[model samples]
Target: MTLQLLNRATALWRAFIVLALLAGTSIEAVTQDNRPLLVAARKKRTQTKKSRATPPKKKEKAPEKAPEKPLEEKAVDLTELDQHGTNTSESYNRLHATQPSSTPNFRTYFDLAFSYRPGDQPVSFENFHSAFLLEYTPMAGLTFMVGLAPPTVLPLYYELDWQITDRLSLRLGRIWIPFDQINPHNTFGGFINTSLLRAASQEAFLPDVWADLGAAAKYDIIRDNDLQVESHVYVVNGFGQGGTDPKGESSSYPDFSLPVARQDNNDDKSIGLRVHGLYRNTVGLGLSFFTGGYNNQGTTNARITMLGADFQAYIAALTFRAGYAYMAVDLPLGTSRQFYTRGGLYTELTLRATDKWKLGILGGVQQNDNNVSDQNDRTIWGGKIEYLINHMMIVSLQYFKDLRQAPGKTNFDVALLRYSLTL
Candidate 1:
């Protein structure tokens, strides 16, 4: 019984061993089948981990890309940009805000002259004359002036000039009658002509005074080219030939035969007209006509006419001027009538010896129709030397010779010293 029990145990043990072997084989097969799945699962888990890591790397790259861009492309704030733009605008406005100044509108000027002349004769005294002129100009188109001549000769005169347009003007006030080549104030200052002293033929008939107070209307026909035409119509006190009346009244009687005396028939007035023209600022021509009558015991009528021409020319630093005048007069048969015709020719030359010194020569001849009885044709020659201390002061020495004869008189010579000042 022991042997049989042992055998059964051996068998049971073998069977158990076999079953263990089979189980081992099945487990191996199963492991082999699952191997690929395990490897795939591990690969999948690795891919998922790699995807998460790459996402984080991508986020880092996005930040780095921003830094790599150009500095000029950086974003800015609109508010700061607007402030900068406003500041630039304000600066531009300030630079353009200031204004410029305006120009002056009016101007005034004055001229004054004073002269002292010493005569050559024993009976002569130093004569002093002075004039003052003031001018105001509000604009170029309008001007006003007041001039004064102190002492006995010329009275004060006022002038108004209004340029209505560029080409036309209206002038009014007392004006000097324009006739002779030499103005009253400019004719050797206070000296009279030799013809007057010798009583030339023309002097017997011609009027003596150089100026008269009158109103005139002048028109400028041509203005631009230094050529112009002017006409004047006026009425003045009757001609004072030989002497002036005590009351400064003009004569009314036109007596032609009366030599030393002028009778006044104060009932009549005289009218005169003149026309003048200038050419190239060098030449001038004028013509005049006058008519009047003296109402004495019998009414006496008279008529006078004049023609004149003047010339001025410049050669280098020297200037030359000359003029001629002619007059004719008619009087009633019974009334004292003197033939009236007078004229003169004059010339002057100025030489600049130095910057402050000047020398001049002057000569003139005069003829009279009435003074022929006294052989009154006269010739005048003079020379002057001037020294200039400045623009406003001058000293002049002049010598003059008169070639004319009166009754028992011979030619005369005069030396004059003149000092002048201008302000």
Candidate 2:
């Protein structure tokens, strides 16, 4: 009975194993039939778990940048006014300290001077006055200028300038005569006192201020970095013979008070020329010539001729200037006019003692005429000390001694205190 029970139990166990194997095979077949769906479901669950585990990696921000600064302009080399006084607009503005203006393309300047001379004779305000100048530029290469001096009847200068080319210019109206260095810089107290040549010529021979109504042309023959050559040519109404005018002016015989006349006194006109050269701003030279008929009568043929030469040099802190002038006038002798000649020369030296101080000395000699035996000849010795208060203001003390050649004539001495201001 025990053996029969064991065999039945073993058979039943075998049947159970076979049945489990068959069940496993059927489930695997069912999974294979839905393989795509099961695979997708497994992937989705894996991705969800991964997203929850990692917090989406906080986005990394770019590094902060610093603020930028403004760009700086490069340095530039500036050139000064050339020999023709042709300055660029920017340079002109810098040189003049140009002020703001409401009017378009206009500029104005004021110059004032005061002088006190302790002497027998002082200069008349009419002869030397302050100035106010105005300039108008309507277009490129064209300009108009007017300058007025107080206590004077007429304008000091009024002109129109046209720059035809880079090196050529034309000017018309009452203009400063382009003769010597002094006329170009004629403001009282602005420069050292007038040289002997200028004073003698202006008082006895040439027109005051060397000014006249004229048309002028300036040509820059050569201009470069450090060298310049310029030429000026002009035609003007010649000086009038004294006592012949309706204005009640008397004749100064043996001397010429050649005043600049508004109208021509004679049919003939005057002609003048000047040539100048500069080297490295250290050396300068000039030559001038003028010729004109002074006789108001159309029949009388009397004329005047002038020749001039000037030089300037700079060395260390010293500046030197020298000028020479020769003048000849024709005088009526019986029937034919005779030519009498006069000549003069001056030399000046200035020392820049300090930024605000300057010391200067000048010496000059003049011959009135060769016919006279040392009668009217003269010598001048002068010294000056100046203090510059600012770029546009100055004060100076000047002393001058005059030695005359005439017998028994006393040597004259004078001292001056001068002040100048520009606006």
- The candidate maximizing TM-score is 2
Query: How well is each residue in 85-193 modelled by candidate 1, as lDDT tens digits?
Result: 1101111111122223221222111222232222322523343335555555556555555545444244344445555765454445444444433332223212244
The regions of model 1 sitting more than 4 angstroms off are: 1-120, 123-125, 136-144, 153-156, 184-211, 225-238, 241-298, 335-340, 352-355, 367-371, 375-377, 408-411
Write one digit per residue (lDDT tens) for candidate 2, span 101-150.
Answer: 32234332333334333333354321233555667666677776766655
**Candidate 1 local accuracy as lDDT?**
0.48
Candidate 2 lDDT at 248 equals: 21
Candidate 2 local lDDT, residue 374: 43
My TM-score estimates for the predictions, one after another, are 0.54, 0.65
The Cα error of candidate 2 at residue 307, in Å, is: 1.0
What's the TM for model 2? 0.65
* TM-score, model 1 to reference: 0.54
Candidate topping lDDT: 2
